[model samples]
Target: MAAVVIRDPLAFAAIYDRYVALVYSASLRVLADVHEAEDVTQDVFVRLWRRPETFIAERGRFLSWLMSVARNRSVDELRSRGRRHRREALNGDTSDDDPATLVPADTDDPVLAAQLHEAQKLVRAALVGLPADQRRALELAYFGGFTQQEISAALHEPLGTVKTRIRLGMQKLRRALENRV
Candidate 1:
């Protein structure tokens, strides 16, 4: 499929369909923001499509390569925004803590599938526990990639209020996950 990707866009699209979710999830987990995650996902695929020749099967599996690229790019993004984040809040500096590390492609292990299912449920429950305003702000900031000012404008709230909501929301999330983490 990759060999034909340059000549056939459909092949590239198929690859996108196969890995987009995984890539996006990894990006989101690392960046913790929807907009940056999406950008990273798009950038990863674009790099693959634009430089198919750079990939050598002899070096490694295609999927692994894609994931490595995604991880590196995401970490780079995080590093670039160092001042914006509380560095200690992240799991670790290594890719070992990456959410994508928990996912393996083309697996048939029932136990692994169950674990993934349970993790999803836990995340959903955590989201549900958040206050409505905090949750909305978190969602908008994390998933929508909106700045604090932008979020305030969109929600028609004061800038300070929006910032407070996001802060309180993050603290709540950390407290909720403190034990498990």
Candidate 2:
């Protein structure tokens, strides 16, 4: 890992070849989007290459560490998408009004729609199960597209508290969703 981190191109390439499939499968398992999974896998490898010093072998096996990094990256991507969706909503984007903007307008795909609807419901339920502060923080950050500073200002809380809420909320939501699947 240190060799890879120290700009050893061969070592880094070897690491990529060894873990790319695992990272891709993990992302796909969690996100269920092939393109997004591929992007996440690439992003994870890029981050690994850039910050090799962060990979501490004492913490766990290399595979475990890599998986943790991949999982964290995927979660961040999901949160980012959530923020974008909220921003678009605030700007008057409505999927029902213009199906083509959200999905293929001519394709009346019930199975795809149903799967999405089910996933949405599960996420909603998981969000509702969170503690009040955690749920509120997540909603403001994710659904309102507010940065941590903005969330703190809106909620009249300290920045650290807001971050804690967001972190805890996401952990709970991830655990809940993982258990379901």
- For model 2, the stretches where C-alpha displacement exceeds 4 angstroms are 83-181
Estimate, for each residue in 102-156, the C-alpha lDDT of model 2 and write its tens digit. 3332233455446545766798789779998898777555434478987787668
The superposed Cα distance between candidate 2 and the true structure at residue 81, in angstroms, equals 2.1
Q: After superposition, how far is residue 16 of candidate 1 from its true place, in Å?
A: 0.3
Which parts of model 1 are misplaced by more than 4 Å? Answer: 86-88, 91-181
Using alpha carbons, what is the TM-score of model 2?
Answer: 0.46
lDDT of 1 at 35: 89
CA lDDT, every model vs. true structure? 0.72, 0.70
Error of 1 at 26 (Å): 0.5
> Highest lDDT, which number?
1
Best by TM-score: 1
